[model samples]
Target: MYSDDIAIRVNNLSKCYHIYERPQDRLKQSLYPRFQQLMGRQPSTYFREFWALRDVSFEIKKGETVGIIGRNGSGKSTLLQIICGTLTPTGGTVDTRGRIAALLELGSGFNPEFTGRENVYMNGSILGLSREEMDARFDDIAAFADIGEFIDQPVKTYSSGMYVRLAFAVAVAVEPQIMVVDEALSVGDIRFQNKCLRRLDEIKASGCSILFVSHSSTMIESFCDSVVWLEQGEIRDSGRPNEVVRRYVDYMAHGVNDSGNKSVFDIGIETEQSSNGWEWIRITDQNNVRALDDYAFKRIRVKVGEEPNASRLPCEPTVIEIECEFLALKPIEFPLFAVGIFNELNEPVIHCNSNNLGTRMIPIVDGQLVTCHFKATIPGLRPGKYLLAIGMDEGLLGAHQLLCHVYDAWVFQVLSPRSGRIQGGYVQVQDATINLQIMKGDRQ
Candidate 1:
């Protein structure tokens, strides 16, 4: 028996494949096994057993989104395929309720010879949609895909992005009770990806469960209600997205090291890889002299604590200190310094500058090394990795000449708060005080 509230349940699920040394070995195993069985003898094994997943178990509640993360061969895809019923599990049982729409491999159910229009109908039928139902939704699906006239053309002529566009369009149009997505969305353009994300948000809001798999920590932490971390085909950890993702990242960066005891940021004076080691991959280029504009970032250093830059709790009072040196090739005046802290998605979550703070800097002469320091308190940012960027410009805020700028200048981590979990959003308001005034009133 299965509960109505449980969208998916897997118990002791395992999948194994036979690894043959050669083509002849596969043939021999198929023939010899049957011959041994017929002769009343034990079958001789001719292949090695490779267990892709072993004793994996979990539950996805109705309307809850879960994220699965692991290394390349950590069996993420295998697990998803089993849950989607495309691959049979060698052992254990999987029970799922309601209609399932999945975007597995790129063009998995698509036929190269069939037109995009034809494949959409075929996929819809596979998802338990009637011909009439698909007919009603076909125009909307075609418009969402935005492939234009290519919808009538063969699927083989479409690019990888186009295939995903059409497939995602069809999948979402089904309005399934459960949505399973692999990393196929990564192939689409930013606009299409955003569109898909918006659609997914709508699905989730409608009480549909989602199983998302991605290598991006930012996406998983921001999108998932819960996360499952798999290691070597087994469940390593499962719980809140922030905690699980932090552990996973720590292990990936420094395996077997006591992550709890060690700090992620090391601000030593002369360490092998100091904060100053970050190279400035300039984003802007110009053939004119303005691009060459006599200014260059020489070095940068960030300090979060006296010991080292370690994980911080939410709502913790954090003072970010930045020291940077620059070489001014020309005379610079009223230099404005900006420090930006970006999240994993490269979105600026925190931006502070001297101009905003009303701190005016003195003028600088050519061939001079200008050193500046910046200090600011970071609000209650959600637990995740953050990157630091620095920018220097001469003149006023509205109109200024770019002197130098470098992104990913430094890195830091924010751990979950001990008192409570600050869920969702980029930054939380610090030290908030609530004053409730109760007034007598009558219900009208």
Candidate 2:
């Protein structure tokens, strides 16, 4: 028996379909199997099996909102259908503790021939609501739908937006304990989407569990407490929203048939380092010289510990140095030197520059090399590979002219101990303290 706190439990869930090459092949297979068995001959199969989902397992606690993210044909809809009881699973089981209201596809449950009002009543009845209960909630549902005169019109004449509006309205009107929404809000306008989100927030406040699917990463990050990423037909990753989303973005941008020869960022230094301590790792050398109209990056270097080629430990401090040379023969004015660190997903984690720190570059003589250095310890960086980016600009923060910007100028990795506190996130908290104080009046 499931505990009271568990809303949904799915174990070894799978779905499969049979594909036949021709219509006659399906008919022959259906008949030949039975006839061959009677004739004491072995039966032959003419169809191929396609597994839409395989051994997918996860659980949702009560009042928790979980987001589902995946590309098309990733079995997201198939899994939702099985949970909503619209489709049967070919293997495994899903145990749901409460009534489920789902808006899977546009115009799925509504009858095209029936009016909007009729469909609402039919859907409510399907959710186990009596006629009197539907009558009591009819006005609220209509107002929430806001399709004014179309309430009396046939649903077949409704637009996609109108269909989603009515379907979402009916789903929420049933007051289900579990709500499943699948990219339906993408069709509506921003204002309508905000209204729907507000209503969902109210429902969630009443202890309803939500399972949402959307392509908007911002929405998932803002609304979901946890996330599940699906790839091909299985769960690729599941955890905090920010971590999973970043990995998913990286996979989509870099991992698709990527040959080792063509990388977005190239490492200039050799892979192996000398055994000498505190060796200088050159990220950009003279061979990587690409000149802009104003200036160009001459070289980039980082000083590390004994194992200069290996991933740096989080406890170690490193120094990054960059050199830029003027391309034009004229004097440059107000030049800015900048450096940034980005994850593999191209999300910027840190950005620092000389201008922001109130340090201005001295007037550069023609063809003179200018150097800038940064030294710091990144305390809580989790174990992963990161990229360094460098750029030179002309003006202030908002109105800067880009002289030259190089992404992935250098690649580095962070190595953390297994028992470290920075286990699964992008940033680490170096020092954290908690204290409790008692009030005199409430003291026990």
Candidate 3:
């Protein structure tokens, strides 16, 4: 039930998209009236109608934070667009209170021709802020953005990071009653992301309703007060943030990794406590152990959300990608890396890009994000606490070199599952494939 203090109410809102047979049908529909009079309402040339959203409804309290999640193409973006007044709903309506500020994309409202100062003022006006009002908040905005002297420089000349800093600063400064944030927050460095998160928390404390959409479940769990899940344009679950995200992660891991069959639904994730939360070991390599003197490749450690790794994997990876909360020594080039898996003797298990998989040719820039995938087809490694080696290796042909370890990383256990199925396996790679046929009807 939506209490009297509700700030937004969405009732049976839906959006439909028509798939056209030919590209020209769009133009025809726009001008169909001129020639369709003789035909008395010609049937739509497009043969398909896809409902991007179906019978979706939710209510937000005055200062509640809501998270929206679904697989790609599940209408998450469309719903946000409708709420932000960027797109119209095919059915139903969204009722909201007060002015709204949206950061659907970084620099969406920027004019490349203008300096950051001018764009800030112009975007502020568009968001309903007056000159005097913006001027009063300008100092706070600039200090929060911390983009140096670039605020007076043309937006076109700003780096991607600088642009994001400025755009986000302005949006938060305008002080709208409702604010919508998309995944663009993933682009910035860790420090900036943390700053933004703190500001968002401050805004929430100030009684502003916020809507957030991100692929990372950890981010959702740590941030949103409540969560809503959408599947194939329909609402699947709406309630606690912890419950919904666990389901989404389960849905993503099914078939690719392990799935708990006891649940009625496919995408439900079961939670349990852990020591610092390092359960599944992802990186592996037994060879190329770094001696204390090996300094060919500089070591680059990882920090969550920026630096080398994120706190959570964007998707339910076949292998468990551990959280990185620390970094190593001084900065190197652009592609520092950490690899983990099983090692022989003391060798690292996996590489920056495994050469055997033809991925070794790719150079890993220092602190760049690289996801190393593995096939868990061969199981039965002796169970114990195994260490996943984090290090730098020079790939084949020196195409790109992995300098060194950002951190020593952590360890995980391989235990036995009850059903004779291997337990603690990181991936769900098919164990075997079998085919049977009746030979010349003899069996029959």
The 0-to-1 C-alpha lDDT of every candidate, in the order given, reads: 0.79, 0.76, 0.64
Q: What is the TM-score of each predicted model, taking all chains together? A: 0.64, 0.64, 0.57
Ranking by lDDT: 1, 2, 3
lDDT score of model 3? 0.64
Clash tally, candidates in order: 0, 0, 27
- For 1-444, candidate 1 gives per-residue lDDT tens digits of 688899999899999999999999999997998999999999998999999999999999999999999899999999999999999999999999989999997869799999999999999888888999999999999999999999999999999999999999998899999999999888998899889999999999999999999988888887999989888889888877765775676467424222232222332222235565432222221101122457877666566644333334345667766677778888886888888877755557888788888988989988898788877777778887876778888888889877666554565778878877576788766667889998889966
Off by over 4 Å in 3: 1-3, 31-37, 41-44, 256-444
Q: For every candidate structure, what is the RMSD over all alpha carbons to the true structure, in angstroms?
A: 13.1, 11.6, 21.4
The predicted structure with the larger lDDT, 1 or 2, is 1
For residue 190, give model 2's deviation from the true position in Å. 1.2
**Model 2, 290-337: lDDT tens per residue?**
335556664455654433334454533444444333343445577777
Candidate 3 lDDT tens digits, 314-391: 212223433322222433343333455542122233444344445433454444454433332223443333444454
Off by over 4 Å in 2: 256-444
Q: List candidate 1 segments past 4 Å from native.
A: 37-40, 256-444
